[model samples]
Target: MKIEYADRMRTVGEMGAWEPWLEFFVEGIRTQAAEAVAQTNDL
Candidate 1:
């Protein structure tokens, strides 16, 4: 079971398999941008 699970775990260089990673990065950028905008508007 352990080896099978390890085989399923994906690396970033794989095409299409990196979608989740990209989504995470985009979400992080969006969250930071929103926080910055809110801070500026409050001032």
Candidate 2:
């Protein structure tokens, strides 16, 4: 998602696209939480 974030950050100053950027950030958090849960379950 580093590439995705880089692409979004570039256009974030253009205006009206903040919603997608926020969604991307939230999705990243959700993804990390899921991975952490799975790792804990494995132990």
Candidate 3:
């Protein structure tokens, strides 16, 4: 997903914006993954 996003950003000449967006994107994914694991543990 990060690779795909980087490719798109590069194509659009927005490479500089990648870092901030990636930080936010990764945090969201991590939070969701943690929640999913917790739910599975509960089951």
Show model 1 residue runs off by greater than 4 Å. 1-10, 13-16
Measured on C-alpha atoms, candidate 2 has an lDDT of 0.89
What C-alpha lDDT values do all the predictions have? 0.65, 0.89, 0.75
Q: Candidate 1, residues 1-43: lDDT per residue as tens digits?
A: 3453334344455554566666666776899999999999999
Q: Which stretch of 10 consecutive residues in model 1 shows the poorest summed lDDT?
A: 1-10
Q: Which sequence of candidate numbers ranks them by TM-score, best first? A: 2, 1, 3
| Candidate closer to the true structure by TM-score (higher is better), 1 or 3 | 1
10 residues in a row with least lDDT, candidate 3: 11-20
TM per prediction: 0.63, 0.82, 0.62
Report the candidate with higher lDDT, 1 versus 2.
2
Candidate 1 lDDT score at position 2: 45
Off by over 4 Å in 2: none
By lDDT, the better pick of 1 and 3 is 3
Off-target runs (Cα >4 Å) in candidate 3 are 1-15
Clashes of 3: 0
